[model samples]
Target: MKTDDPTMLAAHDWDFPVPIAYGPGRLAEMGRRCIELGIRNPLIVTDRGSRDLPFIGQLQSLLENEGLSATIFSDISPNPVDSEIGLGRKAFRAGGHDAVIAIGGGSAMDGGKAICLTANNDHDLWAFEFEQPVPVIGQGENFPALITIPTTAGTGAETESTAMVTHADKGMKFCVWHPDLKPALALLDPELTVGLPRTLTAWTGADALVHAIEAYLVPGFNPLCDGLALEGLALIAKWLPVAVDEPQNLTARGGMLVGSSLAGIAFLKGLGMVHAISHMVGAEFNTQHGLTNAILLPVVLRFNLPGQEEKVRRMAQAMDLSDTSVEGFIAAVETMLDQTEIPKSLGEIGVPADCAARIADKALKDSAARTNPRVATQAEVQAMIEKAIAHAR
Candidate 1:
């Protein structure tokens, strides 16, 4: 896993944050990892939608059979809020849980991380916002060990040190970053994603594609991240459609899992306008993260194309598009979107026209937007939002 790229060497110190075990059925070893982490009692955090699923139930049973007591907390929502984190902390303390096993998609994993970071800290979770980076966890002592199991092929939340949490009153998204928030281990079991619906598979996979594309085009591209971004983009291009068309395709699923993880790693270097805008829309409209990302992908690409033409051309080459033009790559992305049945516009997702200006204003301030190749103004962001809405129509 050594890379010799100078940019990567300069941008990052080549640190792999967590121990990752990736395979088709690695989830079966969760009990052993929990024991190795010295957890006799573990709280399993997941979303309500995934609590009763076969995978969660099976993991719970496996842990119980191994003589580990487990408590399940499934009250988290799609965009986890501070209240949910508080509730999870309460549950953890009540159950006397020693460690956490986050066993679902991004929300569950993030919620679990939030609980772990704040379990010993007395301040509210919002105090750890990414903007100020103060009141940092792991400031004085070690945090609890966490194990993550992602049931989706997107969001890469399991690998990163930050969790995107929604502010309850502000109705906006903020990040909680702490070194301790990084999982002690990530068990990527592609088998857990096989039963996902086609729409979800397409949406999440498209989100991964955006992550790679954005990372590749971000202003501070480093060789290490660029290589990962390029490979991730290629993998998604080759495998996402297959996974969408055939959910049971194990090979396709595996490719997607790897692509998603690579995308996560790449974004650690930087994300861009697509995530910035998508987060605003998602928080405001309660839209699906991946689907919103899919709808906004081409528009953001087009908007950034003026400044990112060279990068887009490079991405086109990686995607095997013969034309090597920004428009060529954009067209290729459009074709992929069409093939996956991803919506072409924001209107399709119930994002109202009137809200466009507000979303733009917020997106202009998003942390991800700052890394975009072309730093956009509020007016420009509004225009792009309008374009996305019209395209969706």
Candidate 2:
């Protein structure tokens, strides 16, 4: 299980956080890991959809057999807002839960993480917004121990310290971050992902690609992230199609899980415009985060291509494309999108033309936008949105 890449090893040093349990059939280890971590009373936070699955009941039974009593909180929505986080926090405190077991997709993991953070903090959740002009002020040390078991292979929520939640009032997504919020453990069981539908497979798989591409392109000095991003991109390029077409293919599923995690780790260095726009659009429209990002990625790439020629060339190499130019890269991505049956434009995915102005305004203020290689203005973002919407039909 050792990687020869020094950068990958460096990225996993003790300082990086998240002890991962990866591979097929690793879901059975969750109860043991919880016990080893001394979590006697655990809150299982997930979406309502996941709660209905047979695996959810099986996991709870496993925990009870291991002497860990668990409570379930599955009222959260696909785009978790502050109200949901507030409810989750209340459940955490009222149930006397000592730790969090976040299981399912991105929304469940993020809602659980937010609940864990706010359960101990006295201030409002937005007080810790990562996009603010000044750095978030907090005690930064105390939180319920967290374990994430991802049933899907997107968002990389299992390993990252940042959580995205929509503001109930503003209808905008904001990231709350603290080093203590990083999960104590991440269990990736590909067997759990075998039931994913083709559309979800395409969306989540494309979302992972956006993370890797943005992380690699963002101007930074972190070689560890660069190496991991390149590797992640390569893996996704090779395996995502196979995974989408053949859901039961363990090798493809496993590769996607690992690639998604690597992409998440790489984004610790930060993301770029695709995430910025995707967050805004998703919060307002309640669209799927990964699908929104997938639709916007090609245009965002075109917008950022002016100064990123050299990096795109390297990315082309990683993607194993014969053409190493930016145009070639964009074409390859479009081809991938077509192959995956992804919607061609924002309009196709229900993002309206009228939201263009609002999305642009929010995108400019997003933390991810600040790290974009090429500075993007509201006008430019609006133009991109228009193009994205028009191109869909």
Candidate 3:
């Protein structure tokens, strides 16, 4: 791996940061953290599916014991739309919440973050959509304090400063960005993820791996992110299967939770075509995000290998591949996927062939495309999609 290409190393800017309270029993400090952030009346934002969880009840009780009044806002969907954020803002205003306590998976966490911001604003949320030649997040200095408690080990939404909210009219997932959108604190408790279903374990774990891989492969000069991504990949490779196989294994769960957060930090440099394509497909077909990334990763790896051979070689070494070639690295990924019983193709996950062109068109316009090592055309992305569909397991 040569480091002569300064072009590949250039980056707009760089930062390595996040405030996290991480451990197996870290949820115990959630209310205390909220109180420290001046949240007397906190809005608990989560998806409907998680509202009934025993932990939710426990969390409410804990807040009550801490002399905090809490309101439950679980009206978000798996892929939260802007309208849902609007509804959540209404809920926040009606409840007169002073702060937000976002809990649950990526969807719930992202929706909560958006809801927290929108609660005090009277303008449309779409005004914040990340546009190129400009920053991803627009100018917004005012926002309520937020604390995130992730119930899943993927999506890294808890660790990022961006939110992916669907625009109902556009029917596409758009990112809302703000430096202030980052939660003041993140609590990572492996116990929260111990009960994740096997299917979700594989899906979200794969999503975490994709985040690391794409971040490593994306052309950038952020060595800190690159290092984090590599370590994250190694952690996922070693621990994801253990987690999926033995759901109650705290060590594996904790490794995955840390790996997922590290991956989130890594992608702050940028993500590549895997995310671009995955976001489009997820918005269109209502597919699971991690599943889509898992299915598309191999194909995107192959697509990105032309000018990125050295980076892929480094990734192979990081993944501990016996064969350091691109093909060998991809083969190792396939074996890992097979071991986890993750489906091999987009079609297997209910993505339609007819939507490939549209997905490709949208993917080319995605913010992630700007960082991809391989500059892909719409036709090339479409061909990759076709190959991914044809190769579905």
TM per candidate comes to: 0.93, 0.93, 0.92
lDDT (Cα, tens digit) per residue for candidate 3, span 1-393: 121222212221122365777777777777787778888998999998899998899899889989999989999888888889998999988988888888999899889988876777765687667772323333543677888888888887776658898888887888877665667888888888999999999999999999999999887588999999999898788788888988988878888888898898899899999999888888878888888899898898888876677887888887778798888888889888888888878888888788889889998888998899888898999999988887843
RMSD of model 3 against the true structure: 6.6
Best by lDDT: 2
Show model 1 residue runs off by greater than 4 Å. Answer: 1-15, 136-141
What are the runs in model 2 whose C-alpha is more than 4 Å off?
A: 1-16, 132-141
Model 3, TM vs. native: 0.92
**What is the Cα-based TM-score of model 1?**
0.93
Better of 2 and 3 by TM-score: 2
In model 2, the Cα lDDT at residue 351 comes to 78
- Model 1: per-residue Cα lDDT over 1-393, one tens digit each: 111222211212123656888776677787787888888998899998898899988999889988999989999988788889999999988887788888888889789888887876676787777786567444544567788888998887787668888887887888787754677888877889999999999998998999999888887639999998999898788888888988987778877887888888898877888899888888888888899999998888887887666787778877878987877788899999999999878998899989888998888778898888887888889988999998832
How far does residue 135 in candidate 2 sit from its true spot (Å)? 9.5
Tell me the lDDT of model 2 at 192: 83
